[model samples]
Target: MVPFGRLLDALSEVPDPRRAEGKRYPLAPLLLFTVLALLSGATSYRHIICFLEQRRIVLNALFGCTLKRAPSLNTLRTVLQMLDRDALEEAFRQHARDLLPPAEPGRMPVVALDGKTLKGSFDHLNDQKAAQALSAFASAAAILLAHTEIDVKSNEIPAAQQMIAELGLSGVLFTADALHCQKNL
Candidate 1:
């Protein structure tokens, strides 16, 4: 179903992590640029910056913002790392919802829920475990619905259920590994 809010407005709800004294860019525009860059297949921070610089004028007109250039690599990385994870996740969920059209009657949208451990996330020296998350993907639209971390003290089952409940995903056919087919799912 089509979400009810604008993506930039949704992004604005995410708490800014930068100090007010030296903040160079607005959080919402920087976030929107980053999102657009990722959707355009820019993989690295440098590539994202390059994407912005290359299309600065056009994108500025499109987004209705007059940014002279993209934020520096250091600023982008630091702000991203310091932002509240929950707020960012909520914003992403809303944006993903907005990307879809209304669901048709009698047709079940297929969503695939999967949990996987992220590679290269284990901090060997710090003794941290590999980070894992449960992701819900709208299969037909080829877009992510939502994802949540499987915390060290918890497992995928609760995370999956929580995500499903929070997104209010009724009238949809959800597919998952056998692990998610247990009672109360």
Candidate 2:
């Protein structure tokens, strides 16, 4: 596998004002990229560091850097928390779009929608006003297409509509349970 440093070098082609001079570490993009890479299969931070260290030779050959150590976990967390979620989401979307195969002109993709609460990640800090999310699934590909957060007291109808609106159903078939049969939905 190509080392993550190499990947970071490639991504660095995109200019970011956030990368100003005198910064202690390039944390946001580095942490975000590292997390995503780890999620893909990198075992641990040490493993990532080892990978990067090996690629350091290559990195120095391409772009000069005097780095010798991988970032600590605490550093990674601090950097990631500061990252702009919308920017990260947009980057993810663009990358996903690029990875997708071209769709045939006449072929309509199948889409399914549904919602469920993530019981494990539930939070109750706001008590009665806490937000809750329901997930919509595209059954054919078994991928989650969209999600909507419902108010604690609100029903699923509004959330369903919000999720549906985010999906592109032109020629695509949508399937859902009776809960989604509401007129406004």
Top candidate by lDDT: 1
TM-score to true structure, per model: 0.82, 0.58
The pairs that clash in candidate 2 are none
- lDDT by residue (98-158, candidate 1, tens digit) is 7866788888899899999999999999999999989999988998989878998888888
The C-alpha lDDT values of all candidates are 0.84, 0.54
Cα RMSD to native, each candidate? 3.2, 5.5
TM-score computed on alpha carbons, candidate 1: 0.82
lDDT of model 2 at residue 31?
47
User: Number of clashing residue pairs in every model?
Assistant: 0, 0
- Model 1: colliding residue pairs: none
lDDT of 2 by residue, 138-173 (tens): 454554545556776786777666656654445666
